[model samples]
Target: MHIKNKLSVAIILALTLGLAGCQSAYYKTMESFGYHKRDILVSNVEKARESQEEASEQFKSALDKFSALTGFHGGDLEDTYERLNDEYESSEAAAADVRKRIDAVAEVGNDLFDEWKTELSQYTSSKLRNDSRVKLSKTKSKFKKMLSAMRKAEKKIAPVLNVFHDQVLYLKHNLNAQAIASLKSELSNLETDIGKLIAEMQRSIDEANAFIKDLKKQ
Candidate 1:
């Protein structure tokens, strides 16, 4: 690798290690307050679900703004562009939060599963050990499913954001009735994409709820 590339890799590794250390310290602090990794994982999953839910609404709102532009008749085109821009910005923020929350859930969940697996050997009774091992396996399986769903939804956000970004940029350059007409042609495809995105988000939210319920039960 080139010198600059090696330095970039070193910086990335250092940041990764720093974040991991901070997360470990935070977990320890929470444990002191009687909150285990399992509890934190559940909380993170819930937050992730909430973020998706909010993102779903924000995306829908952005779509609505985009759709309204199709019927633009004798109004200030600049004002309409501003509204769409605001919605796009809000959608971007919501998508970012969803990604952040999902990462948080994955972090705590991996830690919880790792600790659970390690502690299984400490059990004096073979029966209890086997039982815990089975439960851990089931929980891990469910978590993987939920995380997959979250990731599927997360993947959908970017394309929709890209489309919004393009439209917003196009409007910024050409804020005129003719530009609105051009955008009108793309509305159908955007609607279809947003529809799919919202559906996937709902599926992820449902999976998160199911995982949280199962975790609390166990």
Candidate 2:
């Protein structure tokens, strides 16, 4: 097989395995409810599900647009097309799988949220009971696991974009100055967006962890 094909296979396998592990981790956290925080975690899980869907759509659109722009230009487009198609298919599959995992996680989170709501209702009805710290700790760990899983997914697919970005750079170096400038500008924008997206994801995960820690003390 081509090197590009091999890379795609490896990436797909890594992403699939990591996300599956993430699902299992969340399940375990739900089972160990002493440290779980249902409300915030459920909200984050829903956000994660949405993120996965958005990412997948973005990946697909990029592939389609890139192909339209590059196809029939006839300069080693075959190889590039093959590599890109492989990357797109693999990434899409991984993203879809992650969304499925998120759905499962969300179900557990919703169940826990209902329980918390009932408990909070009782707390409001009577004297506020002592807060449970153990559940908070478990929630923090579970959030970390979700973050780690997302990081792994990002690592797996970011390389393909990096490769494409580098290719654009090479094109800029060899192509017409006007064309090069446009490509460079677009590539720069894409890199910026990717960086920003990753940063936002990290921030969300961090916020979840911090929130869980605060809940632990309550």
Give all candidates' CA lDDT scores: 0.89, 0.53
lDDT of 2 by residue, 1-218 (tens): 99677656654554475467764454444344433545435555656655655665566566555545433344554455455456555555655565565555555555564565466545543434335334534654565566565555555455646645565455535553444345445655555555565565555445545644554564
Cα TM-score of candidate 2: 0.40
Q: Could you tell me the lDDT of residue 72 within candidate 2? A: 38
Best by TM-score: 1
Off by over 4 Å in 2: 1-75, 101-105, 120-125, 129-185, 211-218
- Model 1 TM-score is 0.90
